[model samples]
Structures are given as structure tokens and as C-alpha cells.
Target: MIMMTVLCIILGYLLGSIPFALVIGKLFYKTDIRQYGSGNLGGTNAGRVLGKKAGISVIVLDVLKVVLAAGLASLVSEPAAIWTSLACCIGHCYPIFAHFKGGKAVTTMFGFLISTSIFIFQEFSYFLVPLFMFLIILYLFKYVSLGSICASVCSSLYITAQLLSLDVNNLFIILASWLMTLLVIYRHNANIKRIQEGTENKVSWL
Candidate 1:
């Protein structure tokens, strides 16, 4: 069991460390995404550095990182699968291949949460509700971080509610949800401070 868990995590991390944004930037534009706007190898910065198309493509690829990880883990153990997925998210945030520098965890986190919520719980509402809320928040406020934070909180609340209603002691998932929430918020700390100072970058894609 322990060996499987460790292998799953390693596999997830390797998959997560692909650095698609960086690759895209270098291969097509002859630029380093990390040296561009926001200096982040993330979807938002990919848009800012390359274009909306690049950003969208990068997000799609980034999401696949977690999806692949989860799929691999699901073949081994159900519980290990979630942890492996999260490990992938973390890998995207701090990739070993990239000298531990990577994108914020939001995109990867959403990928895992959405995929798992739908497949495991047989409920698209759990993922869609928060996603709709995220879009609304982003459109109204123009702050991606703000929208992400709010949506993450809502997702956690909804998951907790679902577990409670089903009378399933899914403590691992409950804890995982909250932990992911906090991790995302923490990662957006700079954005939060900028928002407080009225200097946060308003996303232009919306």
C-alpha cells in the first residue's frame, strides 16, 4: 500500500512537471514565460505574455496534469488517488524539473476537484455551481484571484454539505478540500495584498 502511494505520488509529480507554458513560450515565441508579465508560468501570465489563445491552451494542458495523475492513481487505490492528484497539483506549483518554480495551484486544483467530484459523486452540480460562481465573480470584479478564492470556498462548503447529507464520514476528502482551499488562498497572498491596496491586476480576458 505504501509503495503504491509513493509510486502514485511520484508518477503524479512527474506528470505535473511538464511545464507546458514554458515549453510553449520557448518553442513558439522564443521567450521564457517566467521572464514575462507577472513572471509566472501560469495560464494568466501565458495570456499576458503570449496571447489569450496561448493562455487558454496552457490552462487546458495544465488541467490535464492532474487529470492524468488521478486516472493513474484510481487504478491502484481510491484514497491514494486523491492524494496523488493533489501531489500533481503541488508539483505544478513547485516543479522539481523547473528548479521548484512553477505556476499557482489554482488551475491544477480545479482540474482535480472538478474531475473527481463528477466521476466519484456522480454530480456535475458540485463542480459547475462553483465554476459558474467563479465566472460571475471574475466578470464582475475583474480579479481572477478574487474569483478563484470565492469559488474555492464555495466548493469546500458544498462538499462538506454533500458529505453531511449522505452521512458519509469522508473525513479525508473533507480535510483535503479545506486544505486545498487554504493552500490556494495562501498562494494568492500577493494578489490579496494587491487587491487590498487597489493595485491588483484586473484580468483583461473577461
Candidate 2:
């Protein structure tokens, strides 16, 4: 059991560290995406540096990696699934394949939320609510960073509310959700500072 859990963790990290933006950029665009825009190996930076198609492609790939990680871990144990998802998020933020420089963990965190909603809670609302919140905020603010941060906040709070309403205590799920929320916020510290300074980059199109 322990060995399986450890293997799941390693697998989750490796999967999360795939660095799709780097792959797409270097393969087709003949550029290193990390060298442009915010230097973030994320979909937003990929879109800004490459194109909308590339950005959407990177996000879809990144999200699938997390889903795959969690799904594989579920074969071992449910707790392993949750922990592996967390490891995936950590790997996304500081991917070894990307020289320890990586994305802000927004999309990876959403992937985590989606997996947990499917496997653990079986509650789609937990995933859908925050996704809608993210899109709405992005539409209003035109800042991906702002939308991501706010969506993380929304996810944590909504998860907490759901936890409080449930008779069964899901301590691990609650803790994991909050941890990912904090990670998303921490990863966006620079963007938060920029937003405060009124210099944060905003998406050019709605």
C-alpha cells in the first residue's frame, strides 16, 4: 500500500511536470515560451506568446495530466488519489522538467478540483461553480491572474461550506483544497503586487 502511494506521488509529479507550453512552443512555434510574456510556463503566457489556440491546447493538456494522475492514484486508494493530485499541483508550479520554473498553478489546481469532485465528492457543482466564477471574473476584469486568484478563493470557501454541511468529515479533502487555494494565491503574489500597482497585464480580448 505504502509503495503504491509513493509510486503514485512520483507518477503525479512526473505527469504534472510535462510542460506542455514548452513543448508546443518549441515544437511548432520554434520559440521558447518561457522567454516571452510573463515568463510563465502556463496557458495564459502561452496564449500571449504563441496564440489562443496554443494557450487553450496547453491548458487542456495540463488539466488532463492532473486528471490522469488522480485517476491512476485512485487505483491504489482514495487518499492516494487526493495526495497525488496535490503532488501534481506542486509539480505544475515547480516542474523539474522546466528547470523548476513553471506555471502559476491555476489550471492545475482546477484539474485537482475536477478530479476530486468526480472521484471523492461526486459533486459536479464543486467544480462547475468555481469554473463559472473564474470565467465571470475573467470577463469582468480581463485579467487572468485576477480571475484565477478569485476563483481559488471561491473554491476554498465553497468547499468549506460543503464540508460544514456534510455529516461525514472529509478532513483530507478539505485540507487539500485549502492547501491548493493557498498555493494558487502564493504563486500569484507577483501578479497581486502588479494588480495593486495598476500595472498587471490584462487580456487584450474579451
Candidate 3:
């Protein structure tokens, strides 16, 4: 079991480290995406640097990597699988290939949520109430950082609620989710400061 768990984590991390944004940017536009925009290899930065279509593609690819990692992990036993998923999330946030600097793992978390089957489409209305409310607050105020922060907080809350309500036996899931939330918040520290100073970047869509 221990060996299997370690193997799963290594596999997930390798999968998560495939910088899709960087690859897509170079392939489509012959540019290093990290050189432009926020100097981060993430979908939002990709969008800001390479227009909407390329940005959306990068987002989808990143999300797909998360899904692949989590889904493969799910094929294993309970706690081990959860640990593997968490490892994947950590890899996205701090990829070894990128010198321990990576994206914020927002879309990766989205994929994790979707792959876990926590809230199906039928229950999405209930799940989305808080999500939409957060979006509104972020959109109206024109603070993308605030919106993302709120969203991550709400995601942790939702995950905790689900774990409790479902009586999940896997403690790793709870631990991993909490850890991932904290990591997301930590990654956004600069954004948090920008928000406090009233200088955070707003969504262009807003």
C-alpha cells in the first residue's frame, strides 16, 4: 500500500507538471507565455497575453490535467487516492519542472471538484448559489483577486460540508482539501496586498 501510494503521487505530480499553458502558447503563437502578462504560466495570464481563444484553450488543458490526475487516483484505494490527488494539486501550484513556481491552481481545483463527483449537475443549483454570490461580489467591485480568494474560501467550506455530510471515511481527503485551500490562499498573497491597496487587477470581462 505504501509503495502504491508513493507511485500514485509521483505519477500525479508528473501529470500535473506538464505546463500546458507554456506548450500551447509556444505552439499557437511562437511565444513564451511566461514572458508576457503577469509573468505566470496560468490561463488568466495566457488570456491577457494571447487573446481569448488561446487563453480559453490553456484553461481547458490545465483543467484536463487535473481531471486526469484525480480520475487516475480514484482507481486506487480511498486514502491513497486522495493523497495522490492532493499531490497533483501541489504539483500544479509548485511544479518541480518550473523551479517550484507554478500557477495558482484554480482551474486545477475546479477539475478536482468535478472529478470527485461531490455535486452533480442536479445539485449544481444549490452548490452554485454561494459561487454565484461570490462572483457577484467580485464582479461588482472589479477585484478579481478578491473574487478568487472568496471562491477558494467557499470551496474549502463546501468541501468540508460535503465531507461531514457524506461521512467520508477518507481522512486524507479532508486533509488534502484543507491543505490545497491554504496553498491557494498563500499563492494569492500578492493579490491580497494589491486588494488591500485598491490596486488589484480586475477581470477584463468585468
The top-ranked prediction according to TM-score is 2
| Clash pairs, model 3 backbone | none
Q: List candidate 2 segments past 4 Å from native.
A: 165-169
| CA-lDDT, candidates in order | 0.82, 0.89, 0.70
Tens-place lDDT digits, model 3, residues 1-206: 67877888898888777787788888889998778767777777877788888878877887777767766666676565556666777788778887777788766765655545432222453336445755787768866556656766776676567665544553456667677668778888988888888877776731
* Cα deviation of 21, candidate 3, in Å: 1.2
TM-scores of the candidates in the order shown: 0.94, 0.95, 0.86
Candidate 1 C-alpha lDDT tens digits along 1-206? 88998999899888888888999999988999898788877888898889998899899999987888888787777666777877888788888888888888778878878667744566788789789888999989998889989988998898888775543336677776787788789889999999999999888863
Ranking by lDDT: 2, 1, 3
TM-score, structure 1 vs. true: 0.94
Q: Mark the regions of model 1 whose C-alpha exceeds 4 Å error after superposition.
A: 165-169
Ranking by TM-score: 2, 1, 3
Q: Worst ten-residue run, lDDT, model 2? A: 164-173
Worst 10 residues of 3 by lDDT: 118-127
Task: Report the number of clashing residue pairs per model.
Answer: 0, 0, 0
The CA-based lDDT of model 3 is what?
0.70
Tell me the alpha-carbon RMSD of every candidate: 1.8, 1.7, 2.9
Expressed as tens digits, the lDDT of each residue in 79-148 for candidate 2 is 8898899899899999999898999997898899889888778889999989999999999888899898
